[model samples]
Target: MYRDHSVGVVMPAYNEEGFVGDVICDLPEFVDRVYVIDDCSTDGTWDEIREAASRDAAADDEPVAETALLADGGDSALSERATIGDPVGRVIPIRHRENRGAGGAIKTGYLAAVGDDMDVTVTVDADGQMDLEQMPRLIDPIVDGEAEYAKGNRLLYREFRQDMPRFRFLGNSILTFLTKIASGYWKTMDPQNGYTAISGYALANVGVESMYEYYGYCNDLLVKLNAKGMRVADVAIPAIYGDEASSISYPTYIRRVSWMLFKNFCWRLKVKYLVLDFHPLALFYVFGTATAALGVLGGLWSLYVKYANGDPLFVRASLSLLLFLIGSLFLMFAMLFDMQVNEQKEVQIRE
Candidate 1:
């Protein structure tokens, strides 16, 4: 119940029996409801949750005193009356029938929060990679009407140099660049960062029908929100790296990320140009691609003709060079304009 709003924390777990209880115990006490979602774990995760819930229910029913003092200055100790109180545990554990991946677990948590009518839903990984102490700071902007979604940027961490993985560091950098182009949030860094908090209104607005279910979930959500005109803001949060093992394979990683990138790019073209009618950027992109393709084809044809004739190179060389140069310049300018437009959009939102 921070800032007049009920905060719900969702921790998605799968085969996380050892760490699940730790996560539940570590969550802040002020969180009105903490939902532990077991995405069909094969281990004793369900049993652990049941045990925790039972213990919590018992604690909630513990006896507490309620006393009223008289105006006659009665002793403070004797004026109180003991009454049975609600358990200290407000955490609820939910289990899924089958495996739905991390994204699916998140969607489940989100739907639950929405049903509960919570003011905000904060998604925290069950592996405990994110700092729980920074939860309030991440939720503050959304609560204050400054942004619809708030994301944590690990690179902004003051001590990012300490122990961040090299591969993850490089992968995040490349993906961030590509996602900015696809999602139109050029100002955002670490688009793959999943430590995010969203306002209830925004969550409801972002319908879950077409949400991603794999590793691409975070990036896909960013694009969807951008297309829906929801503003996303980044908050500085430190990275916590430990024994968490990543199960992502290179082939699967490439396929998922490529599909998401293409989907977002096409969606952006359709919405920003056709549906919204924002600017001429779409036309420029189309024209640039066509011109560049034509120029490449023309150059190849000219070279073939010259090879067959074994004659004058003047006509072929001049036309090919001219078209290639003009097409390349046009394509470059189009990309530059797209970047500028995206930057301007971010600036306007901030202002």
Candidate 2:
């Protein structure tokens, strides 16, 4: 165990036949278990997971080398010792009958980890894009009680940012801004990065079963964690891009996730400010949103009226400008209040 806490990695595979085995074999030795969930891949992903599990179970004394041959290939020459020890941990293969999203697979793994009494559970992608060696760094905050959840932040360094595509980087920045406002974790970035670790307490308390079961799950989880006052740490980790195919449509994914965040923002305000304890930030947000909407709409209507007829636009313009300025001030104050309230919840893990 790492830092005296039982570590488990959850891998969600979807048509990742080529990389699943490598990911499984590359897990750190300190990890106690690896849960591989196959999301009804149309390829041989499940077969590869089974083969990896067998190799892991068979290699009792030494690490086993990974082979590309099928499990039933019956090639004796392909069996070789791996570079690590005994494949580190036992591989538990879980297959879903229908194609649930990556989030669903992760929830399944979380449940299994909780049931097995694991202290820390880390979620790693099936496609070899995540560095398994960084597992310890990801779990450190949770193990140390500094944070209930920790997530990889690929934008922490310039070199790491250069590794991402230009378009993706821009998209990530926009989403990060939205997520900051929605999740109330202004210090965190890379909202889409899925490499994360969570304590058992968080996994059980965050209501995993009711979480969003799709690509937006990461952002959604942040909002829920914030509502529960769960501390979150942003672990600096590099992005690793490979030949793995992406299943997301950028435009569609962004739109859906944006809507989800808007809804989550409202829910958080209601649950945290209205139901749990009354806070002035809630009023600030309400007034700010309403004022901004009226200002924009009123401005547009005034412009239309001026063009349609020779009506005086001075009063309308002044009113819109006044409303806009007041709304912006309220929003700024609300943001300050939010940051102050959540300052203690931002976990800082020193390297």
Best by lDDT: 2
lDDT of 1 by residue, 201-299 (tens): 888888755678777788888887877777777877776767777666745765678678877877887886679766677777677777777777877
| lDDT, candidates in the order shown | 0.71, 0.82
Q: TM-scores for all candidates?
A: 0.80, 0.90
Predict model 2's lDDT versus the native: 0.82
**Which pairs clash (backbone N, Cα, C closer than 3 Å) in model 1?**
60-86, 60-87, 60-88
Question: What's the CA RMSD for each of the models?
Answer: 10.6, 7.7
- Local accuracy of candidate 2 as per-residue lDDT tens digits, 38-151: 888999998898888777666645443332222343223212210111232377677776777888787767766665567898999989888887888888888778999999
Which segments of candidate 2 are over 4 A away from where they belong? Answer: 61-89, 349-351
